[model samples]
Target: MEDGKIKGKAMVLSGFDQEESAREALEQALKEAGLAREAIGIIVTTGNGRKAISFAKGDVTEARAAALGAVFLYPTARTVIDVGAEESRAIKCDATGKVLDFAVNEKCAAGSGAFTEAMARALEVPLEELGPLSLRATQTIPMNAQCAVFAESEVISLIHSKTEKADIARAVHDGLSSRVVAMVRRVGLNTELVLIGGVAHNPGFVESFKRTVGLDDVRTAAEPDFVGAIGAALAAAE
Candidate 1:
């Protein structure tokens, strides 16, 4: 998950259908990381267990503590926005990282890594090239919608119109940032807003976000995409 690094502890849980495999993978990862076997904890529960049982599972308790640690490290974080591959989460947490309130966009691909990847592919560029390319734009092209399908269609239109790739990419960044800003605003804007998830890696996305939200201080984790896992690991440490 660290892009090649295999250091650090991890507490992992797979879906209810893959509980056994998930446990095995966590245990093996712990061993490979040279962490103490006793430091590793495994808890397998059905989806119903998570829903019906409020009790903390073995490893989950630690994961929670780790998340809290990361939260505490940032003094001004009251809102944490995580944009992942398939879904997104806007978590409103206290100083302790307790989930005070939250919203998620899990049912669609419109505002996620998948959306950006699709756009990047359509533009004939590598995903990593997107941020820098967009940053080079001299003008802002308008992207009219948050819906991925609509946006893709719009991109085609731009291409046919001879719109500059840099301009179009900038528009895409603006569109995504607007969507994320809306989600964060729902939780109420807080100082030192933290942006997590794979999308945070995109400088264009981050810059657009800062501008759209009109926030002077927007921070990103060293490993933006892995904040959840890092937070989970930090929670486990506690």
Candidate 2:
């Protein structure tokens, strides 16, 4: 994911059904990144043969990796918010991204990058245009749906009403922010609130987040999207 300011990459070798293939993919990525091939870290999930692993050169991963590593470093961080492509997560962790308490909204696309992508498509715009376009809105149109289907309908209505596309975009950002902020509160708004995952790239979303949560400090890695991979790598380092 590219946030204009930061970029991250993650390769999940899911559906492999074999540890060997998974291991090969992991090794290849590490070698390509110029990381030591001997360095391996492992994390076992609830599913069989579905392991999350990481490889790096040092005692820990890189700085982006360290932000995720920080979660494992702190056993008391009860909340982790990860906003990504298909869904957004409010995870309660034990100082590690090892989810202890977690809530996710995957049933709908309203709060995910997918929703933003769809909107951008409907507006005949590119994803890179969203941030600057949203910043141009003189006023935010009200969008009241948490489900993507309903939100799409609302957006169409706005288009019919001749609402400025910028206003509509800002409204989408507002709606998503409200839902995610509620998720954070539901998971118990603790300090060290780490905001990771892909959607963290949206400047409007970030600004709306700061406003909605009344949080003076929000933590985001240089590469927000790859925090999970980085976390997996960090766990393996341990």
Candidate 3:
């Protein structure tokens, strides 16, 4: 986290029963950035797993960190739509990278990445392939379920109906985008929209977001997942 840039990063997937994947990511980022643990100055943490890392000097909110991180990387960024594994949020930012307004969907699982994972499992398709496969669909399929549990059942029904997995995948992403779109609309769409978090890796979701929100030109950090970490580092530098 020197010079406002992540040095190295590592990740320990949930399968390992690890909460602070950043512990490994931090070591890797430091090594990648070419710094030793002792050489580091101060430690700052943010995001859902902040409490799991006992070594942090301080912590910041995800919206604050994400705003700063996106602005730091893309100077023109004004809004950030962060879709995480279990929750999603939309943040409106000003020129100075200060968050002006925000909306979060933490109560529901249907709008999060976990929903897509569940659908993929129901369709007997690999989770990683959901996004690309969804992109292959020629016609949009409507998904009515508003809950992940029901959505999972819906996906199973789609599979039983012999519906193309691609259409089902697209519908899943569209459902997520619809939820996120509601949040973004609440804050109002500003230029230089940015999408962050693990779900941004889903290309299908990205396109669905653009279409549903009616805004393309969405910006993303080079290391999208680390935007929050980058913002925390910038705060630490300050």
Q: Report lDDT (CA) for all predictions.
A: 0.68, 0.63, 0.83
What does candidate 1 score on TM? 0.77
Using TM-score as the measure, the top candidate is: 3
Worst 10 residues of 1 by lDDT: 42-51
Candidate 3 at residue 191, lDDT?
64
Q: Each candidate's TM vs. the true structure?
A: 0.77, 0.71, 0.93
- Candidate 3 structure, TM-score to reference: 0.93
How far residue 3's Cα lies from its native spot in candidate 2, in Å, is 29
lDDT per residue as tens, model 2, 1-238: 1112112233553554555555665556656655554432333221123333332223332223323543753444456777777777776666445555566666578767788877777766788788678878899667877777777788888889999999988887788888888877766777767777778888767766776788776766556755665554544444
Best by lDDT: 3
The total number of steric clashes, by the backbone 3 Å criterion, in model 1 comes to 9
Which candidate would rank higher by lDDT, 1 or 3? 3
Error of 1 at 9 (Å): 5.0
User: Judged by lDDT relative to the true structure, which candidate is superior, 2 or 3?
Assistant: 3
